[model samples]
Target: MASRVVRGGHALTEYLNAAKAAEPLYGDIQKHVLEAALRPSGRRQDVLHPSEMVKPDWCHLAAFHRLRLEVEPAEKRRTTFTRENIFQEGHETHTKWQRWLTEMGRLAGDWHCAVCDGYFWHDTTPAHCHECGAPSRCLTYAEVPLNAHPLRIGGTADGYSPQDAALIEIKTLGLGSLRYERPEYLERYTVPTDVGPVPDLTRLWRDFRRPLPSAVRQTQLYMYLASHFEDLPVDRTIFLYDFKSTQETKSFVVTYDESFSGPLIEAAAAIVDCVATDIAPRCNINSGSGCPSCLEFEEQK
Candidate 1:
């Protein structure tokens, strides 16, 4: 037992020595990361994507600023590496699921012609581009562009399944969102219950769950645009939320409601109108309704 203790002590000392030797290296790497993150990303804010159409009041101002920036170049504010990393992770999650759906032959939607850049829904006969007569070999559905021309909103839907006649919108949610949405979730799941001392991670998802209001609005807008543009009669959306920690998923079938969606479109139209007139709307930053993009606009103004 004394020999064993001596060996353990030696191992601990080796680890401590190695960690001490690596301290400067780790510090250098962290400095580089922070510097890279702080560097202006130089990303263009040309169009206000559909996902960004959340705050109604800020929409017009944000859109107007984007248009103004097109004429006058400006440095865009850089987000923290943590927040940007989360976004990248969410994008990877969406890509993985979409790729899986494609591999499974479960994903459906219109085919985009690589040759002429035309879009046509999948049909019984051999698919071909209507505009340029490109064969099906030149068609793809990945990153399909969608536009609400009237509202001047554009974004790519995650996926679509003709079988269910529903559009898909995938979102990755971290524990922070759960804390905001259900503060009791962590406590209830991580604490010892009547069963045992170990945390019951399986019960993490409980009642009192609904899709984010912004997500619903975004999905509804997608459905409306898909139906109106493609004539696919898409009136429903499959809103899938993937938990980052557990890799578990919860889904909601969001049916499009004209009552809920109408005002959103109207709000988008107002933004477009504001942009057309080159008259910026009042800033909503003071009202606690602006996002990072809105804040950038406020700063630029």
Candidate 2:
């Protein structure tokens, strides 16, 4: 049988409707859970990551815990950070987009031409060094293997400090989805519609609810990637929760505390140690589960 997947603001509602028509028992269960979830505090506490609890180390080994995080489906979404938040229909191109980003950095950026200390402001758009005639470079993007969760881990190492990155991804979960479901929470939001230089477009945030499991998992995976690069700056790991919904987009910045990297580093190291020593601690109660990731040490003993 072919697997089926459906999504939208009314996806769950439609899903439950199908269930009610076909399987009343399971359908009622879904209704019960969803109704509770829609309550003021109906969230499932277990799903939320605890600040004190570091996730199981993701060694990407044959180990299951590590593998699950690596293999899990990620939200399919896309986001763009443009300087112009301005646009013209059928007028924008990636080159133009990059140029706009470069232009916006004129005053804020402390970078100078490598060969000659010329100002980028006066140079031609997509400026070349006036003194030495060198070209300006835009940020590079590299694709990651997780298609269920397409992500690009790219960063730049300028002279000032270590490398920093803009965590870009195809985001399917809108920012409005993560917010509380208040009466006024369902307001229309402004979104950019153009990726090229053609023109900027706008859309409304309709029917978007809490994030999908895949999207949040992808966010965590992005954080894990940050641990891979010990030199990755804290500011680089931060992401703008910009997920597009039918015709419109919802956006907000989701920045993490720089200190959070410490936990990720330690978790990464622990996973590495497990792999180096060939040990798989029980991930949960070992009731013939063949795992090692949970349970107190005494419980295991």
Candidate 3:
């Protein structure tokens, strides 16, 4: 099937709609659980990792957990971290930042497909019209009648290799006390067979999770999907550059697999169904706190 992936504000709207629809069922529960999770202790004053400050979606968190599981064994056994481990750590931040930034950027027309011409919300103005080769100017939200659900798709490649028409994703991190002055760190880190090492996973994970940004993941996803669908060979690399200490940290290149999409598609489908039916699905995993909506419904009993 053609990818229905949307970008920018339209994606945010769909997510918000899903959240709103699920509110009665899962919103309050999620909020309450997050509140507790954020505050592991009774005191709410305790600070959290900067990345934790931004509430990441379940998919990003789950992906990170999966990545962690892949690496834990290596770390436990004192073996060199594999390419997969580094990739996961680099990806953890990418997923979190992409969602947060995309949502925020929607406020300023930052979200839209780079490939197509139509606005995600309204199909009237064509960014590029086929008939006259005339570019349809983007009308401000105020000027144009917009659709409740805008179509968001497409993204510009950051590190594109024009010669090969390949997109390269470089994931990086800033230098820290430990990583700094350690030449061996870069050698031990893994890279895709295409890209060279010099990119360390351990340090990348630390930085990636520290300050979350958005565009990174969106770009990666778009590139991955576009390459996959177009049957193009795209080079995706994550360069872990340590800005704090001014060092070129580590880099890795990775390819996507069917396993990655299985859960995401399932989650997206579930959310879409919930929005369509206005029915929140049950949480398969018991959170132990009990379902608030159900508890309230029972209180009336």
The number of the candidate with the highest lDDT is 1
How well is each residue in 1-301 modelled by candidate 3, as lDDT tens digits?
7533323343334334435654476554433333232222332111111122122333322222222222211111111123224445565654443433233432112224333533443212334434333443422221111111111112333233333344444344433322543444444554556654446555544444322233234334544444545344555433333333343344444433334334433544454445345565453333344343223323433
Give each model's whole-structure lDDT. Answer: 0.65, 0.35, 0.35
**Model 1, position 225: C-alpha lDDT score:** 75
Q: What is the number of backbone collisions in each predicted candidate, taken in the order shown?
A: 0, 27, 28
TM-score of 3: 0.32
TM-score of each candidate?
A: 0.66, 0.33, 0.32
Model 1 over residues 138-202: C-alpha lDDT tens digits?
86666445676666667778887777888888887666666665556656767665886554556
For candidate 3, the lDDT comes to 0.35
Q: Better model by TM-score, 1 or 2?
A: 1
Q: Candidate 2: lDDT over CA atoms? A: 0.35
* Cα lDDT, model 2, residue 143: 24
Which candidate would rank higher by lDDT, 1 or 2? 1
Q: In model 1, which regions exceed 4 Å deviation?
A: 1-44, 56-59, 71-81, 109-141, 180-200, 284-301
lDDT of 2 by residue, 1-301 (tens): 8544434445455444646556687665555444433334432222212221333332222232332333222222221112112121112322333343445542112335655655442312335554566765532211222111112122221111122344433343333343433324333443245663221123233444434433444445444544444323333322222333333444333444445445544544554455446675444324454323332222323
Residue 84 error, candidate 3, Å: 30
- Provide the lDDT at 48 for model 3: 16
